[model samples]
Target: MRIAVTGREGQVARSLLATAPSGIEVITIGRPELDLANPASVLPALAAAQPDVIVSAAAYTAVDKAESEPESAFAVNAAGAGAVSEAAAKLGIPVIHLSTDYVFSGEKLAPYVETDPTGPISVYGSTKLEGELRVAAGNTDHVILRTAWVYSPFGANFVKTMLRLAETRDELRVVADQRGCPTSALDIADAILAIAARLKADPDPALRGTFHLTGTGEATWADFATEIFAQSRALGGNSATVTPITTAEYPTPARRPANSRLSGDKLAATYGIRLPGWKSSTEIAVKAILKNAI
Candidate 1:
């Protein structure tokens, strides 16, 4: 099967390309070739690739920066996403779009389900929610996979940031009030490929809709950093002392959700795919990064 993914350098797109199964052709487009912000580039680029399925992985992901640049965020996350879905619809192909757990207000005491009413707390969340709506409206054969706390060896994510900071700092203060699952980009890529294969084989209505795809467990930023240090220590890498702090202590332009945990029961029931625990996935990513560093 041929799969066309957006954002060649993104964490998810890179993971998909690196771990794609044999016998599958994966073509990635980004920047000059397929800029999500430019609607005119969507159809022609996708048409030339002629993919069996489209994975809409590109987005303006600067959470704090989005607060100052809402227009750019909407242009890429909302309108650009809709344009991709529309192109997929015209080509009569399925499009799997990655979304965020930020869609929720994060007030729920329990993990969020797909049916939960959305109440984004920040510009990033709001734009992602709008993108979800637009993609659904543009194409019926779409799978909106909402994930959270994504990190991997590639890209500028929490894991890499923590490691980089540890090089100079003796102690790091992380927000303890905010809690969510730390999903590995590699795990997400695996799920996306599985979904693509299934969609290519069978266009089941039961499979088309929104679904929560994340790591099996949850943790606060403090807890996540602590684990990262623990894993790094085991790998003979630099480790820092993690100090837990409240969200109010460290303010940002964008207000983060206090609890953005998403349940993966629906995805498990439908796709029979469940991601590994956050700790295991973190260890895998940390080890990979450390290995590459040496």
Candidate 2:
């Protein structure tokens, strides 16, 4: 399968490039040539790649900064996503979009199902929700995968941030009140490839739609940090004491979901795919990071 994934250096895009199986071609399109903020550039750049599938992995993902730059976020996440789907529709191909768990208000007690009502509390979440709608409207064949708390060997994610801080600080403060599934970009890449293959193989209506794709388990930022430190210590790398704090203690411009756990049951039943638990994936990611650092 020839897959043209948006964003040259996004965590998911980089993971997709690294994990794409043999016989599957994955091309990344980004910047000057293909800018998401400039929707007009999307079609031409993507069409030139002539991909069998388009993975819309690019987006304005600065959660806190998004509060100040709603227009920039909306332009990329909402309008940019719509353009990609429309381009795929014109080319008679399916689009697999990467969305977020932030679409929810984090008020629910249990893990969020696909049918749960969306009430995005922050500008970033609102723009993503709008993107989801536009993707559906622009292309009938679309796979919108909503994931949360994603980290990997690459990029500026929580896991990496924690490890970096541990290099200097013995103790780090993290929010304990807010919970989410700390997902690995590598695992997401594997799942995306599987879903993409399935989409190319079959035009089954049951296969295409919105689905929650996250790590098998959940954890708060503190819990996640604790686990990362544990893994790093195991690898003889940077380790830190995680000081748990509440949301009230650390305020941001964008209000995060207090409970961001999402259910992966639908994705499992449909695709026969389930990502590994966060701890295992975190260890693998930590090992990779540590190995690279050495």
List, residue by residue over 1-294, the lDDT tens digit for candidate 2: 899999999999999989998999999999988998898999999999999999999999999999999999999999999999999999999999999999999999999999999999999999999999999999999999999999999988988888889999999989999988989999999999999999999999999999999998889999999999998998899998989998999989999999999999999999998999999999999999999989
| C-alpha TM-score for every candidate | 0.99, 0.99
Q: Let me know the TM-score candidate 1 reaches against the reference structure.
A: 0.99
Backbone N/Cα/C clashes per model: 0, 0
Candidate 2 is scored at a TM of 0.99
* Consecutive 10-residue window with the lowest summed lDDT within model 1: 17-26
Residue 58, model 2, lDDT: 97
